[model samples]
Target chain A: MAAWGQRLAGVRGVLLDISGVLFDGAEGSGVPIAGSVEAVARLKRSRLKVRFCTNESQKSLGDLVELLQQLGFDISEGEVTAPAPATCLILKERGLRPYLLISDGIRSEFDQIDTSNPNCVVIADAGESFSYQNMNKAFQVLMELENPVLISLGKGRYYKETSGLMLDVGAYVKALEYACGIEAEVVGKPSPEYFKSALQEMGLEAHQAIMIGDDIVGDVGGAQRCGMRALQVRTGKFRKISPEFTASPPLFC
Target chain B: MAAWGQRLAGVRGVLLDISGVLFDGAEGSGVPIAGSVEAVARLKRSRLKVRFCTNESQKSLGDLVELLQQLGFDISEGEVTAPAPATCLILKERGLRPYLLISDGIRSEFDQIDTSNPNCVVIADAGESFSYQNMNKAFQVLMELENPVLISLGKGRYYKETSGLMLDVGAYVKALEYACGIEAEVVGKPSPEYFKSALQEMGLEAHQAIMIGDDIVGDVGGAQRCGMRALQVRTGKFRKISPEFTASPPLFC
Candidate 1:
């Protein structure tokens, strides 16, 4: 396919992925990828509007900004977007009171939201708090509710962690779907609205924006499907996407 | 399709399903289906051999017997067979120490076996104990191990419980399978070996045996595939199996 640097010659906006492209999961957000910090600094100095988009549903937006800043990336809270805030908005608009199944570290993200006698189940990567009791409670809620709703922050099958590529909330989301015979509402990457929202905030048309990330499906393919150009960095767990499945390889950066 | 009683004319042995056929989940094992008790009594009086085979891996064999006896069915611990004991035997034979993911009530079933430094993950219906922490631990164990094995007691999608047809361990088992990219060895009903083992124990061939149960897939289809005749009872959640999918309708009793 086409190359990234040449296509970005006239791009007005950039949507960046955090975990793999900017920093490796092995170093816990401390280690930046080679030239990534400088790349961000250069982009900030340029006229291009930049937005940092991540599928990490475990942490809040503030935490992400802090993490990125710690790795010497020029970012702000307003410029960083994750699945948690969008998921919470959907919960409110749908008039859903959610039984939050998420990590304790990020529960504060839902601090302002109502959680009493929840009719819907909102699941995220809850780290140590994901227990059988919580899943059963969610299952029972679905069975009991006439119209039960299951909202998953991100449907990522797995993610790179310090140990290795670990199982993510997508597996649990699928389990609940199989058990309850209900479909979950994914509120993160690959959910077209997530990309549309970020593009809308940047005031850039889909044609002017490019998504840069290491993940093929979530970042590269998702953005391409959203009518934006995509750049797949060779770093991190990047696999060569088959041409039959995708429009083209994300312009390799 | 031929009727059940007429087709059983010369059947040497009969495999029976427990829940929904003999007992109701709502009644807490105290209530029996209409004439089901006397039916079992009549079967006991006849020359036909009988064995109760179930995919209910949550309870031990003794508990099943006690529940059956409480419902006025003529059943002994030996007459009732479940996946737990057979799965334990397989685990031992394979020399795989398992990280058992099951309910606390049934953990006693695997008490005799060693659970140290487990290389395999054995999952059953953990009920309230099926938490994110336990599933994640199992996932982490599978990731860390050189060759991890996943053994599911039964791959039933759901089972009748007091609340309703609650989620079964199969859902969680499938979740793990999806996340880890591994197939689980299902050790319970619908598995050919499970049916073969029961028939072997009765000293009868598969062709000489008939299976009677409410579930179309687990009981009827499973038995019929193993060369045994199947009887699908109209009681409980019985649905008409499409002619194309099944050999013929089990003689509706």
Candidate 2:
């Protein structure tokens, strides 16, 4: 067995990051990464449970799955643990109506949640929707509430897009945090709750799964913190080795 | 003499903060604070050289002076050290054309400087102009530069407006800083260069000047850090005693 295969011996499930791993972040429709289709097929052929965990807030799970399918990846909406759906679930569970500061593409995911009289602020990768009016409106909503609840989709600082690296929700989240003097609760990758929920959906323990991703903090650090074995892939956003993973360099694939 | 008067005995120049000290941050033309008009007249009558040092980037220096004149302040454009004019001067001195991400009101301040092919990004309190498109545009400009230079007007987290506290340029500056992994050079209050410029206009050293304002960090801490005596006014944005000034609390007015 290979060294990586030896490390995955006890892994019962596979948690994969979609964007940057299976496909690069292009303008509209993403181009599937080379061999990612074969890799997904190989994973499905195995007895291990496969789950696609992504912090992609720019598109709906269905749309994302459709895009992946068109790009020749064996991905389904049911197998994905995306931020919007996870956030919607969290909002429904807490009975909190949110004034969403997210991309228009992901708005339908929150259709079930009441947003008329918002009790909290839900922010995501809003892209061009992150206008001052929208941000101030969200700020006003958060300020009006006695106990402001700012729920961020993910806390990635920046992401590699086709144009170049673009500002992510974390930067805006930090802005709101500084302005409001409050911390935001992140709902996507690196949040232990998000990782745990993905694990629970797979009917597997944290130690029973192996997370494969390209993002150093969001994917590898997050999964590792949640007690899951994680592999760092060199494709997509993986520019260089971070100091955090230097000690355990064998995890890189 | 009172303790504050005693502290001001050696002060050769007075750097007054316009918005918070002279008047509250009302919508249009600010209503003068009670006794502020009289206080300005009194300062004018005194031997001490007085200069208005403001981080107000929402309007041009001329407009701000006009508004203050309307609200009954003894002021002139030459006697004011506003961030916009100071930033324009810096841009000219450095021979760097800027792609401005500032409020439309303050655009005239940079009219003298070349903005055709920007070598740097200049940001300020853009108000409703702090949209995703503008921010992204600024980000793209900075990313394209070989050595990115972000010049921020001020580093205030938030400011008190008539409605409530509003996000300032600092928060957006931070967002850009995080996105590009670069630090911004602040051209307004708390920046030693800005303070020194104000003092240079009065022909006085840092120790020979006094700063009086409501903003604890921007006015008091900034001036104090630059070796000037500073007094905190219990007006705009002064909610509680910051620990940084607790040791010398007698400076409050």
Candidate 3:
């Protein structure tokens, strides 16, 4: 057997990052990576349970799944564990109303939550809506509350797009954190709870699952911290080998 | 003599913060603080030289001086040391053209500098202009450079206005810094060079001057760090007593 195949012998389940692993794009369009569609199908054909874990907050899960399907990927909304749905669940569980600073495309995801007289600030990839007015409004809402709550969807610094690299939600989250002198509660990617939830959905232990992703920090490092074996791919935002990744280089790439 | 009087016995010059000390307002109008205008005249009557050192980047020095003069302050444009004018001088000295991310009110301050093809990013209190497009543009410019340079007008987290406390340039600067993985060069308050320049203009050393302002960090702490005796005021953004101010409470509050 190959080195990768030998390593995956004991893995019962797999968590895959969608953006850089399956496909990479901005807006509603995505160009599937070469052989990625077949790769995902092949993984599903095997006995291993599969889950798509993504930190994408710009689109609704349904919209994202539809986009993936359009590109001939065998994916479903139920199998995708994204940040928006996780954030919505967290809001519902805590009974917290959020003043959302997110993109227009994902607004429907939070339609069920009460937003009037918001007690907390929920920030995501706002895209062009990350204006001074919106940010200031979110800041004011947090400052007015006795105990300020800022919930960030994801904490990626920047993401690649067709145009170029663009600022992400984490950068704006840091801005609010600095201005209000408070740390934000992140709900996606490297959050231990997020990773654990995905594992629980698969009905598998952390050690039983393996993660394949392009993001070093959010995916590989996050899954590794959760006791899962992780593999990095050099397709998307992988610039160079970081200190943390030096020990375990990308096996598949 | 009293404790404060004894402390000020050797002080040859006074560096006064304009916004919170003399008046406080938002937009174009300002309401002068009670007895502040008369206090300025009285200070000038004494032997101590006085200079208005401000981090007000939303407006030009001419406009700021005009507003102060309208409020019965015995002041001129030359006696005021503001961030915008100082930043322009720095850009010229370094021979770096900047893509300005500042408010429209202060745009004229950088008229002399070449901005055709920017080599650095200059950020300030952009007010409503801190949009996603503008910030992303600045980020792209910085990322494209071999060595990114971000020059900030002031590093204030938040400032007070008639409406409420609003986010300042420092918060946005932090956003850019985190996104680009680079530290910004602050050209305003708390910067040793800015303070020294104010002192040099007034023909006084750091030890021979006293700083009186409302902001604990920007005005009091910054001046203190530059070896000057600093006093805090209980106006504007001053909240509870911080650890750094425990030993030196606001003498004039």
Candidate 4:
């Protein structure tokens, strides 16, 4: 183990980002990254607690589990964490019926939930369904509702897909925000509460666990803000890390 | 004519806004305003040069002429001007093939133009077609094309529709601009060049022309900036004209 790797030897729990670090979208069929399967196998052999942390709002939790398992990862449904559960909790607690502006692939996650007479707008990357009619409806709802809330799954600007870097939910979310004159409560990575909750689920302290991911802002920056050590991989959406953002610099794994 | 209307009698040319002034969308189907049709007829009988200037990117120039004529206005296609023609002209002059991001209603305007291997993005009110896939493609093209130009039909935030004030192209254009990190060149009303061109085409100087509209910003504000007299009608999207914006105030007609 390298010096940074040796420092992480005592880590009891590992939080890993699925996309870019473990699986590359460019590989088609969500192929696992080279050596990531072995790395995960070794972690499993060591009997360390592992959780796959992801901000993919396009798919449901069950779908994510199936994809990860098919890609040769020893991950279960319980071991995967995403923003949907947290978002759902918030909606229920606040008594808000969300008009989900998410992709069709993930709409099943909220199928059982009440969305009629929606007073809240839950936005994610809706792909081809980000139509003008839907957006206008959301805007009209915001205008008509008193103190309407907007919940964002993630604020990622772009994602690396099979083709190339494509815009995520951030741009479209910002458009709704600008037009409605409201800000969205982000529910995914980079939120300290979200990271802390994941750590708590693993029965580990922030300092005793390490996070591995490709995205600097959503993973490294977020994990570090929660006082967890982070490792940044150069596989997906990793351009060049700036020195100014090096306070909790990820150990390049 | 009212006392305010008398002042515009000496005006050699009239630059009129279509939406909210001559035609009201609140009546659903682009219905003409009360008495406005006869008013335009009187102007036509007087042989006063008149041009219908609009920022409605939802329809084509030919369609606008047909609608205005159906509403009892004696107007020709040549007397109608919109952002689409100006945008098309710019695309042709710059030798750029446009990936048009406009409404299906107006897409027919560009059917005769070449759009293969698009090097420019022409954005308008692309109602319902503003999908994530299309925006990502535009962003990618902007990143890949050498000096890719982004042309906006208008930077309007909302338009008074039959339903209510609905989201316009401004929000989407701003979103694309934010994601791609580029500013779009607006080609519609409020652009001083657009107003000046209308006056030139009418064979009249800006000072000798009078502009009339309901929109405070896109109509009155734009014409006054071009050194033309303006009239603010209380029909469409016009609220109370603030004193702060009264330096080049339009005559309330």
| Candidate 2 CAPRI grade | medium
Rank order by TM-score, top first? 3, 2, 4, 1
Model 3 lDDT per residue over B8-93, tens place: 87899999998778888677888887778888999999999999999998998898888888888999988988888778888899
TM-scores of the models, in the given order?
0.79, 0.87, 0.93, 0.81
List the RMSD of every prediction in angstroms: 5.2, 3.7, 2.5, 4.8
- Candidate 4 clashing pairs? none
Which candidate do you rate higher for TM-score, 2 or 3?
A: 3
Note the residue pairs that clash in candidate 3.
Answer: none
**What lDDT score belongs to each candidate, Candidate 1 first?**
0.79, 0.84, 0.86, 0.79
Residue A143 displacement (Å), model 4: 2.9
Give model 3's TM-score versus the native structure: 0.93
TM-score of chain B of each: 0.89, 0.92, 0.94, 0.87
Give lDDT tens digits, candidate 4, residues B73-113: 88888887789888878888888798888777899888767
Q: Which candidate tops DockQ?
A: 3
